[model samples]
Target chain A: MTGWVAVAGLGPGDAALITPEVTAALADATDVVGYIPYVARVAPRPGLRLHASDNRVEIDRARHALALAAAGGRVVVVSSGDPGVFAMASALFEALEGVPAPHDLDIRILPGITAMLAAAARAGAPLGHDFCAINLSDNLKPWVLIETRLRAAVRADFAMAFYNPRSASRPEGFARVLDLLRADCGPDRLITFARAVTTPEERIITLPLSEARPDMADMRTVVLVGNSATRRVGRWVYTPRSA
Target chain B: MTGWVAVAGLGPGDAALITPEVTAALADATDVVGYIPYVARVAPRPGLRLHASDNRVEIDRARHALALAAAGGRVVVVSSGDPGVFAMASALFEALEGVPAPHDLDIRILPGITAMLAAAARAGAPLGHDFCAINLSDNLKPWVLIETRLRAAVRADFAMAFYNPRSASRPEGFARVLDLLRADCGPDRLITFARAVTTPEERIITLPLSEARPDMADMRTVVLVGNSATRRVGRWVYTPRSA
Candidate 1:
């Protein structure tokens, strides 16, 4: 059997949000590998093996998928959102750097609806204008870099989306971010906290920066900070096209 | 009949990239309205009507959809990519702002794969770090604002994706942008030009900033500029997770 690997995105939470391209990849796979939560999203079926690992073991999971593919297995490395965006696609390429494998591996990266876009859709287009998406987890990069990006984004007046905003191990990072944002964006700027977007447990709140508390966001929440011209129309918050 | 409106994304170009949520919305819609190209993507049905208009008439299209929904017609406003990202979702809210209609209309914003992410996945993940998406068109926003944001984004070391890079009306804009980016980010930086992404005629090219010409990007293309740490890994171009 000719072996191949596909790094596919499952989209954010909802099955309906998943594209047919990813659905087809999942259907064609002999083995699916990803984080525990992401792997559980694939349906249980005969002749297909599911290998789910923990969060911090992304490199190991990428290697496992690559190894299985090299051994004549049709593998799909699943990511919760678009694999290219702070997800498995980059890690897969990173894995390739260490392996002295042939250049011609049949690998494909399928895109999906990311958390920030889903969150933007649920909350009325706070990312309607120019925007930046920043992963708030400091495990990969330094906190100083995060602060610099945040301040620069605010100064540029672009809307911002944040993923992995807070974790149990480093809950204080989001607090410092909030403090920094408050100072940079001032009190009246709008901020949106969307938890579990597109799922049954989804909760969305839009408030001014002055009233934003760090506790409003968690691991499951994606936060959106509006640009200077973003505002409320009726009940929805949106950034105007002219901005 | 009870009416509802859904601003849905059709993904970049391929029908396989469209989400089930958007497909369902199109099936349930009695009237589908959008730009000529986007409206043409929707299949015609027995009772369904398609309203394809010229570009730059987003507000008029938004008003038409709102009026149809107010008169109990199920309307789906189609945007080529994600509806909320430089697309129709914000225009709908802008229309709502002008009219004092009932606060709660059954309006929904469905997300899809934006061109940048689709292009990013097709090429490797140049957006593995924090990134910004800016529309290069100066029609909506000032050129000065674009220049300021470009400088800020580069200084922040964020990977950047540019939409609507060049148009017939202002073909010189992208050349200026290239000049500015080269000055700020330097010529050794990597840039990817992905045109007609996910379509049959798709073409993606990656080269150093020194070689990127103005004509390389047109209205159909999405341009990605990698961060300082972004480099070529084998045949793929990816930004490392650590950066």
Candidate 2:
């Protein structure tokens, strides 16, 4: 069999949001690899082998997928939301950099509905205007860089979407982010916290920056801070196209 | 029939990239309205009426969709990518702001795989780091704001995806943008021009900022400028997870 590896995004949480392209990739795969939760989203079959690992082992998972594919197995590496956005696609490429032998393997990155866009759609179009997406976790980068990007985004008057805002290991980062936003964006700037978006436990809260607390977000949540012009239109919150 | 309006994204010219949620919405739609090219993507059924209009009439299209839905016709406003991202969702809300009667109408924005992400996936993960999306068309906003955002994005070391980079009416804007990028990002920074992405006519070209020309991008293209750390791995271009 001609082997290949497809880094597929499953979208946010809803199965309906999964694209037919990703679905086809899964169907054609003989082995699937990803974080435990994401791998569980795939169905079990007679010939397919599922290799699920814990979080923070992304590089190892990518290496494993490459090995399987190099051995002539069709491998699908799954990620929640778009694989290109803070997900598995980059990690897979990073793995490729560490080893030269697998450079010739067939690899494809399939895009999906990322968390920010899904949250933006659910809450109306707060990101309708120009926007910036920042990952708040300081695990890969320093806190100073995050602050700089946040400040620069505010200066540009671009709406902001924050990923990996809060986690049990790093609870203080999101609070500092909130503090910075309240100080820079002032009290009335709109902020949205969408938890487990598109899932059964989905909860969306939109309030002013002054009213936002760090506890409003968790690892499963994606936060959105609007530009200076974003506001509520009746029950919906949107940034004007002109702004 | 219970009428509603669903602003749907058709997912960058590929039928398989469209989500089941949008497909279900279109199947239930009695009338579909959008720009001529986007509306033409939807198949016509006996009961379904397709309303294709020329471009630059987003507000009028929004108003028409609202009128249809308010008159108890299920309507879907189609956009090429996610409706909330420089597309029809915000325009729909802007139309809602003009008239109060349609405030009670049922409306939903269905997310799709946007062109940038599709292009990024096709060229590997050049948007893996913190990124900003800007619409280079100065139709709604002034040219000064675009320049400000571009400078700020570069200062913050964020990769950028530019939409509507160049059009027939405004051919000189992209040349200016290329000049600005080369000045700020230096000659060695990588830039990718992906035109008609995910389509049969798709073409992707990657070069240094010094080598990018104004003619490389058109209205059908989405341009990606890498962060300082973005580079080529084998034949693929990707931004590393850690900058």
| Highest-lDDT candidate | 2
Q: Which residue pairs does candidate 2 place in steric collision?
A: none
lDDT string for model 2 (B55-152, tens) is 99999999999989888999999999899999999999999988776567799999998999999999999999999999999999999999999999
RMSD (CA, Å), candidate 1 to true, equals 0.9
Q: What TM-score should be assigned to candidate 2? A: 0.99
Docking class of 2: high
TM-score of 1: 0.99
Candidate 2, A106-151: lDDT as tens digits: 9999899999999999999999999999999899999999999999
lDDT of 1 by residue, A1-243 (tens): 888999999999999999999999989999999999999999989999999999999888888988999999999999988999889998998888887853768889999899999999988989999999999999999999999999999999999999999999999999999999898889999999999988899999999999999999999999999999999987789999989
Model 2: residues with Cα > 4 Å off, grouped in runs: A101-103, B101-103
Local error of candidate 2 at B106, Å?
A: 0.6
Query: What is the C-alpha lDDT profile of model 1 across B195-223, one tens digit per residue?
Result: 99999999999999999999999999999
- Docking quality (DockQ) of candidate 1: 0.86
